[model samples]
Target: MRNFMSKKLLILSEVFHPENFVINDLAMHWAEEGCECEVLTRVPSYPAGMPLKGYRNRIYQKTHSFGLPVHRVGIVSGYQRNLVRKMLNYMNFCFLTTMMLLFRGNRYDRIFVYQTGPLTVALAAVISRMLYRQKVIIWSQDLWPDTVFAYGFRKTRLRMVMLNVFVKWIYKRCDIIMVSSEGFIDKIRKMVPGSEVIYVPNWPDINCKRVGIKSLPEGFNFTFAGNVGKVQNLRNVLAGFALFAEKNHPNAWLNIIGDGSNLKALKSLVEEKKIPNVNFTGFRPPNEMPSYFAASDVLVISLNDAPLFELIVPLKFHSYLTASRPIYAIVNGEVTRLVKRYSLGVSADPSDIESISGGFERLYYASQTELKNYSANAAGMTRNGYSKEKNIAMITSILWPSEIGLKQADLHRAM
Candidate 1:
């Protein structure tokens, strides 16, 4: 068998450690598994869009995380709420990373692009492929043209044509295009005909240790963890909870347990509407997430009612399932289907306040035995479909097939 450990690997991502992303854990795990891995990414300025303490926005800087060497490029600050800055942030990463790869392209045997944000970040890998002929694999967490349009971009005919062409150009260059959702495969295949597309879903990267948190209020807690962005539909979630509270679910509380651009507005809405029993615990660490989940009766996952959202499954879904909490899926499409099909929890439409209120009532009145069944079902689903060990092994085999004595055909069959 070929010794894959002798090969050097480069991970290209827009986000990494200190930014609370799955790419951080994946890189650390690869290093632990004896892979000679290094990371090239932008400086940590996510959600808040400012450099983390102890770091600066420099043209070029080097850092280390868990003993893994990290290369950082400067990013445009204040992109969190500014549209122009956000565009610049994406363009800046694409420009700097492309230039860096052009000079140091020959050092690695393969390049792995952990694509989370703009697809433009993958341009560097495409450039390296052309110049150094290195094998490139992209794990696309977000789809491009659809996301671009979904996020308030004007979809003119000319713009759509240009965007489609650009997407195809980047995707066609990669050796394999791995998608986080099965629904993405069809859309991506249509975009780049004959392109190699693989489905490699995300797993729970957080350590779910149920530590005790004394600050939790005395009530049946319904916790919403992760980013509190506009797309998360927090406004409607709050409205639904308020309606349920008005109907005399006095002991029920809604806990919003993360920070984002929409957090300030959501807090303002809470104060303005005089919403009762709603608590905003701003930006807790990932290590403390399990404790919050432990104190909760149901974990809530929601997204805006949009066609684009239906085609993607958020990473929090896996984390919630791993936490083994009864889910309250107040969203549409894929997540709702999963919750109902597996009996993991209850589902409601995100755009409908009444539906969400009804879901709350149902869960509030559910017997302890029924809630336990939901938790049990969630655990079973995680073990069977979202197993961290199994998915990571599959990824490793795809990256270094020779080490496992597997061919491309065998890998496809395994998938």
Candidate 2:
């Protein structure tokens, strides 16, 4: 391999800084490793669907964050509330990013496309690989088409065929395909049989800082943090929590800490049901999550009963493990398997209200020793392998094998 320090690394993604995405951390890590890392992305507007304060959607914007240069092309402003607008935004991003790559003469040794959302953004990477002979690596955080349907899109044979064809094109161009979940391995390999598909789990948001426990609501709190979206199956969570509060634990409280597209509807449901002991704390910064998690008795993770979810290990699960709080996993498949395997916490079916209630009951009434055991398991899992450092090492090995190998040896020696 060529000298890592001399390598120019470019990251192409629709979401980057100012949006709570993990690619920011990776770009910083590569810069620290002495690579001339740069990120080509859109003006930061995501989850909220509007440009963040102090940023405007410009034709072209150049900035730096944590020592790495970020080049923002066009803006795909509001899409969080409306589907039509969302599609338009995605298309706009794809068009602008593709155009920039075609015109920009900046050379890079390798290009990494953070295929966290739409596979359409990979067009830039594909162009780079095909036109410039650059190595392209994709770290897929969400499976395409499957995720499209998961978002409530109607699936059809024609749609499936078209998406399959598009997905194959994207996968074929990548030198290496990395998935954030182990369950995504077979599916990806089946699409690109000869491509190297590796399992590289995502770490918790690197921006999160561990803080001392802060003041929390009265009574035992079961906290569900992060995006409050339909895919989270939050309706079932609210229903199950209501049942648990009414029937078994009157003093227990359900705290939802995040904001998303489903926030308004969810609030309406809460008002309609007049569910007691429920509090909604709109989104908070990542740095504040540690204190919030520390204040809670148990952390909850729930996802809708969809085939796509069965193959996912949500990023929040990783953050929950780091919090060392006993988890109540109202999810199925790989998430359930890992929770049970490691004795992280209780697991239940997301679609079954009664089952979810039972899961909450089990955790709320669990003995201190039992809770300690679960907490210990959570810590053990993170330390054993699932960590930001480990994930970065896995990716760096693929992108800059010789250099990262030397860096790892130095790290081991320093340790």
Candidate 3:
């Protein structure tokens, strides 16, 4: 960008890391691009109720390992399934953030917020604009009431009426709205035609998997990593893996490596069903993720074919694709479309054991020639299509469009 003056940017999110979440990386990327970024977020406690080993809940300040200043906002230290409790958790984050911002700190040039918990963050943005006349860039990967409804808050007439009105208000409130995938952009456009819906795909820990591949184990070892929340349909995945193993398939294994609110129920189901060929490796550290991914033969990502998730294009997609392994996305819509467009992986039905079984069956025995081509395409997606450098450049252009004065060549060069 031509303009080099310092611009203060504040990012608000509940899942910033050393906890290893998407917003953490996104903020860090912005910092590297020379934006003066500060993150105001909850003291990290996710997946499990306990705070990450060294991180305690405090009204204190600390710097990320990367040296970006982080301002801690209070939040309920739980991930309960009770809708009321979940709402409380979300409210705890939002209200605390809003209150925290009100009484503290210098005014920022712009505000950026990550969506996951409450609509209150939108309220935070509105208040920021009201109190400081600040501009906001909202990264909304999922819609609010639609998600609340998915989590079984089936709306009554009055509740639905209020939420719909609230949503339209936020569309106008946000200066920039970004979604994680192209499918989401289309859906948002239909609702808020004049609002901007930029497609900002999440970046991966690309430093990993930059080397040559290793020899596979005697059997193909597949992995499903990340949160097994309501959005993810993992029950059918277990059943499907069992079906593959039942065929006495000489070379097949499944590893489920992560914990979430549903862990107890999912684990109990695994025991009750005696599902063979499946193993659950409870949560591991962020740095451990890269090596874990590198060891896998293929990566599996499952989300219910809910239209909301169709547009999501989870951040994990980048990690899996970057690892240069074939992916089996038990998902449809944009993710499936991208996988097919790039000839990257196989697709399977989310809730059907048969489709999952068949998908693994075909991939497990793929000819070396075909498998190599798929691997190449997945790797190429990172180097030539969605590099972090490219994403950061695009974000910079969006932020300082006049300064960049970019031509068509600069845009395509990013790809």
Which number leads on TM-score? 1
Going through the candidates in order, what is the number of backbone clashes in each? 0, 0, 0
Per-model TM values vs. the true structure: 0.97, 0.94, 0.89
Let me know the TM-score candidate 1 reaches against the reference structure: 0.97
Winning model by lDDT: 1
Task: For candidate 2, report its TM-score.
Answer: 0.94
Model 1, position 8, has a per-residue lDDT of 88
Consecutive 10-residue window with the lowest summed lDDT within model 3: 209-218
- Ranked by TM-score, top first: 1, 2, 3
Model 3, C-alpha of 403: deviation from truth (Å): 4.2
Compute the lDDT of residue 261 as modeled in candidate 3: 75
Q: lDDT per prediction? A: 0.89, 0.85, 0.74
Model 3 has a clash total of: 0
Runs in model 2 deviating more than 4 A are 1-3, 206-208, 211-213, 402-415
Of 1 and 2, the candidate ahead on TM-score is: 1
Residues 231-252 of candidate 2 have per-residue lDDT tens digits of: 9999999999888888857679
After superposition, the stretches of candidate 1 with alpha carbons farther than 4 Å from their true spots are: 212-214
